[model samples]
Target chain A: MELIDNVSVAKKANVYFDGKCISHSLTLADGTKKSVGVILPSTLTFNTGAPEIMELVAGECRITLKGESEAKAYKAGESFNVPGDSSFQIEVTDTLHYVCHFG
Target chain B: MELIDNVSVAKKANVYFDGKCISHSLTLADGTKKSVGVILPSTLTFNTGAPEIMELVAGECRITLKGESEAKAYKAGESFNVPGDSSFQIEVTDTLHYVCHFG
Candidate 1:
């Protein structure tokens, strides 16, 4: 994604991954926490405790939200929202760059 | 940074940082290794064993190559080359997103 001119780096930036995907967390000036990450080719499931907006910074992926019958495709510059306390599955055909905003 | 379509994620990505900066290593399809990272506001020095191309993906920083008397500033979309077996200093005034390609 293009750089935002006014964001402040987190004082204690940390990296998170489990070999399949990787990401770093940062806190903005207004105390909003976000993570920018890359997801490799895999079919993975994730559970969320908070609402999330996942923005596709690069590449593409197919996402199947909870209770959904079919998966949806999202490419670069697109985004998908997941409700709090919900789960979703992502089928990545290629390396995908994403920024997840959590609330 | 905008993700390249042909690049493949590394099978084994390990996070690296000393609380000042955070990055994850990825290996491309052609076996080239690259790192995507974020640097917080700080002045830090790094040594390289191989030639490196540091691409500024987001924010800005002032960099001083070894043996240089003055520092140069680079912003998003800009890049700088560092020679192998040399060291460079980076003065970051803001959160900086970067991708480092090693050869």
Candidate 2:
């Protein structure tokens, strides 16, 4: 879906990597927390505290999970799973719009 | 309040100025529309279509409304208004987090 209905959203944005990545925090009606964000064309590494499912809504990127050698390309309508307490390297060829589901 | 409760948020982000500014569109339960966004350190001009009241959540900037000579300094907890069909120039020294309330 293009929207998350009936949710509460934080006003302040979360800026990371000097603004290469930006996200807004969201809490669902049932208290489920999620984030919608964008990653500009750049290479960056992200660490996960909670297991995360990155759902791509737009753009493209190559992702390599921690301990993996091959970088797999993912685009809009695709998703990837990242284990908790792990990390991943991403090479974004296009600006990426994604919904991050934690835990 | 720190959050906008009981709203619907778009999954995709609105990326502008080559990613210098990023935002997510939100719709209140009653159908009022708004956006939460961030502006990195930069000087930029923005033209408004609907009359807007920009509420600052964090960071600082100097804003010069269209047809105005002086730029006013604004920071967190402050807000500024922009007329419809008009524009404004903004110089953000620190990273800025804002919520744009539109007509």
Best by TM-score: 2
Evaluated on chain B only, candidate 2 has a TM-score of 0.98
Over A45-78, each residue of candidate 2 has an lDDT whose tens digit, in order, gives 9999999999999999999999999999999999
TM-score against truth, every candidate: 0.52, 0.98
True contacts kept of 1: 0.00
DockQ of 2: 0.79
User: Which 10 successive residues of model 2 chain B have the least lDDT summed?
Assistant: B1-10
Per-residue lDDT value at A17 in model 2: 97
- Over 4 Å off in model 1, which ranges? A1-83, A86-103, B6-17
* TM-score (chain A only) for the predictions, listed in order: 0.87, 0.98
The CAPRI quality class of candidate 2 comes to medium
lDDT score, candidate 2, position B54: 98
- Encode model 2's per-residue lDDT on B1-103: one tens digit a residue: 4999999999998888999989999999898999999999999999999999999999999999999999999999999999999999999998999999998
